[model samples]
Target: MAEKGLVLLYTGNGKGKTTAALGLALRTAGHGQKIFMIQFMKGNPKYGEIQASKFIPNFTVVQKGRDTFVRKGNPEPVDLELAKEGLNLAKDILQKGEHDLVILDEINVAVDFGLLKEEDVEDLIKFKKPNTTLVLTGRYASEKLISIADMVSEVEEIKHHYKKGIPAQAGIEF
Candidate 1:
């Protein structure tokens, strides 16, 4: 890890964005670093990461969104409200200098879906503490997000089992 922490953005259509973020969280936790993961647009309790998180000490995970997928350009009031709540929480988490790493999972998708304003995300990046590594994970990462990131990785998907009619499995795809 960088001495001053690093801003990392994981985006693209491929799977493992969140998986990579969680892998970071796990690695950080193994080293006794605190990690706070705020999952935007993910209210599903069945995700393997969420369940695995229960066993990791100092690894806090919060899911803020509806279980059902929010339609693009036609989100429900609840979806908007939940995303706002998560953003507010993110602000507080960043300002307070609480955790070593803060992961905003699926936040880019939230912005793309109009559940969150891009300006607010820019603010999150701007206001983050110097020593806090902020990790944003999700598809459709905005240009602004790419610009602010100290490290950016785009997960490109050439092939996926889901394309072959393999449903999302619990441990792998949840």
Candidate 2:
């Protein structure tokens, strides 16, 4: 059994939001605890973390979007369906309490982009087991989510390599 779990949120218009969550997942896996990540609005199997999870014990990564970018305020029907499917999977993961750490990757963006409803995510958080640590990542985290979270980290982008004409490198940003 795990210690008292926390509801953590990492948000803002900066990089490392998902990186921070992955760091925590790594720590959890280091302790031989289970970790599950459901990535919303991202379906690229080539991502470094998705590739690395294959070698990590008791760690699972599920992607729920296509390789194409989702247009804000006009997401496709398949995007909506995939997001809903991911949310339902998250709910089941929380209820079952099978994983010590659960990461809802890019869920805030999904909600902000109208792919998923805020209330539904809120209720999912409420339904989470006491022993399961929940981590929500992505920008534009709602006030309600912040209020409910035990800890919230906003990663403000002071500077970025992307603005410096540097493209995303493999294993660094994926």
Candidate 3:
């Protein structure tokens, strides 16, 4: 079989981007493929990513960006720094060619929020390993990214509990 990686971009206004990627990661890990995840725009320790890391071997999950919810107008320097670190780690993993799949979780939000530059993302895409599948998740994906992706999935929000003033529940949301 030809060992080549493909780019996967998941974007939309609704939810499930990260969840989709996580599902993919779990599937890949079950097949004995190494996986790595870099989470951007997320700092909460009580996330599902943390729990997955505990049992999954050959998996690394890094959380960067602010712990608080993102605001449109205000972005702190710490958030930017954390995002940069996450991007750098993703790049390093991609270049190393160690993992079979690398998930840039919430990268679209990072790029949209201006924490991660589009140019750097483009460079990562350009230099990615031949057999390293890359999955980017978040809303507001860039046109350039979409064009390069082998598979693009958009999770549209038809209905959400948050709209009805329901808080994010554990296991389901996290």
**Predicted model with the maximum TM-score:** 2
- What candidate 1 gets wrong by more than 4 Å, as runs, is none
Model 3 / residue 23 / CA error / Å: 0.6
Tens digits of lDDT, candidate 1, 66-153: 7898999999999999999999999999999889999999999999999999999999987789899999999999998899899999
State the weakest 10-residue window (summed lDDT) of model 3.
65-74
Winner of 1 and 3 under lDDT? 1
Residue pairs in collision within model 1: none
Candidate No. with top lDDT: 2
Q: What is the TM-score of each candidate against the true structure?
A: 0.97, 0.97, 0.95
lDDT: the better of candidates 1 and 2: 2
lDDT of each: 0.93, 0.95, 0.88
Q: Please give the RMSD to the true structure for each candidate, in Å.
A: 1.3, 1.2, 1.1
Count: clashes, candidate 1? 0
Tell me the tens digit of each residue's lDDT in model 2 across 44-86: 9999999999999999999999999999999999999999999
Query: For model 2, what is the C-alpha lDDT against the true structure?
Result: 0.95
